[model samples]
Target: MPENIVIIGTSGAIGSAFTRRMSALHPASKIHAFSQSSTPTSEGNITYHPICYADEASIQDAASLAAETGPLDTVIVATGLLHEGDIRPEKSLKDLSAKKFMKIFEANTITPSLLAKHFIPKLNRDNKATFAAISARVGSISDNRLGGWYAYRASKAALNMILKNAALETARRNKNAVIIGLHPGTVDTDLSKPFQANVPSGKLFTPDFAATKMLKVLDSLSPQHSGKIFAWDGQEISP
Candidate 1:
């Protein structure tokens, strides 16, 4: 069992839901809930840590704190950037800007990789362990059709490459470690709230529902599944 499970971006809908689910399933496990925007809350079996992935020092400090709790078996990077004040995804090349591109890449691409750098050493090599980051289905280049949201799609695609490379290196050192990307589908969260109006009936998932689906996938993952991206229903998405 995972004695230490860390969920970064615990302030977000999916992150918080994942934290609660982990706490419920493995009550004895330590759940490290790290978020930059969330205030610390008292949740049994869950410890909160203030973290900002933009700063390497913050992540290192948080990693150090989690290490004190013991070996980490599961680490989830649920942080993502879809939109922010004055910055929305470009619908066309004319709307794309260098600043917006960098911002999306910073959060979607760099953060998960940075987390892996700090937390990979803490993974349980003696047992099956997983490190997952929330990636988007649009990141799949072959799956692309609509072709909007250029920056968001490209950043996620970049994130997938990083995870794939990390998974390969991780397997060389820890044969039992699974480092993979997850696509949570169109969850009904603030990240998707702005663009969810046209979503088909019964397609938009609740945070809890999405979290459960992802946990099920994580539960079944093996080291052999590393370097791949799985969707909410456990099906693989081609990169």
Candidate 2:
């Protein structure tokens, strides 16, 4: 039987790219794409659901809708936020606003955590499954050599921790399920456009490329690899 997959954050660049890739590879699979903005234009094998990541009720509703179709084999979360332009002011710890930090936490960490809480339970134990969430390299506490963007970094770190914890818990009840945190590198998207000046050429990947790589990694994962942090290039990253 074809796998059932649900993709969150479907309106973003990477999310849309993953949707297209999955459609091409598994045409018979039931693919549900959830996004916060305008409903994604549907393709032959994909269904779109409007979702608000920051809202718990919206997430629960989306989970309910997804479960109605069938048991999910995979749920990929592609949501992320980087402060773009002057929308967020740059300031040191002493000058940072609590509201700004909370906003970052809501988007980068809390939302995805909620996704895990609601969706992972919907997976079928009879089939091996994977839950992959898009995370950032900056989330690594050990790899934090340059210390700016405190809010973003901390939020992602928290996300990583939660995924790890969830993986451990899931293994007890669903040993065949794999939960992973993936870092997609610096893809060319509105979220990363403002910060790409420092990214080396060729190192900066397109959303399509990143999505393809992420899917490959996800495809390769097994329950043995649960709770690991991996980059788009297939290398394991430090937690």
Candidate 2, pairs of clashing residues: none
The local distance difference test score of model 1 is 0.92
**What is candidate 2's lDDT per residue for 86-183, written digit by digit as tens?**
44534467647787788888888899999999999988788888889999899999998878788888888999999999999999999889999999
Report clash pairs, candidate 1.
none
Question: Which parts of model 2 have CA positions greater than 4 angstroms off?
Answer: 40-42, 84-91
Candidate 1 per-residue lDDT, tens place, 1-239, comes to: 88889999998999999999999999999899999985666579998878978899899888888889777899999999999998898888899999999999999998888998998878888999889999999999999999989989999999999999999998988998999999999999999999899899999999999999999999999999999999999999999
TM-score of every model?
A: 0.97, 0.94
Which window of 10 residues has the lowest lDDT sum in candidate 2?
84-93
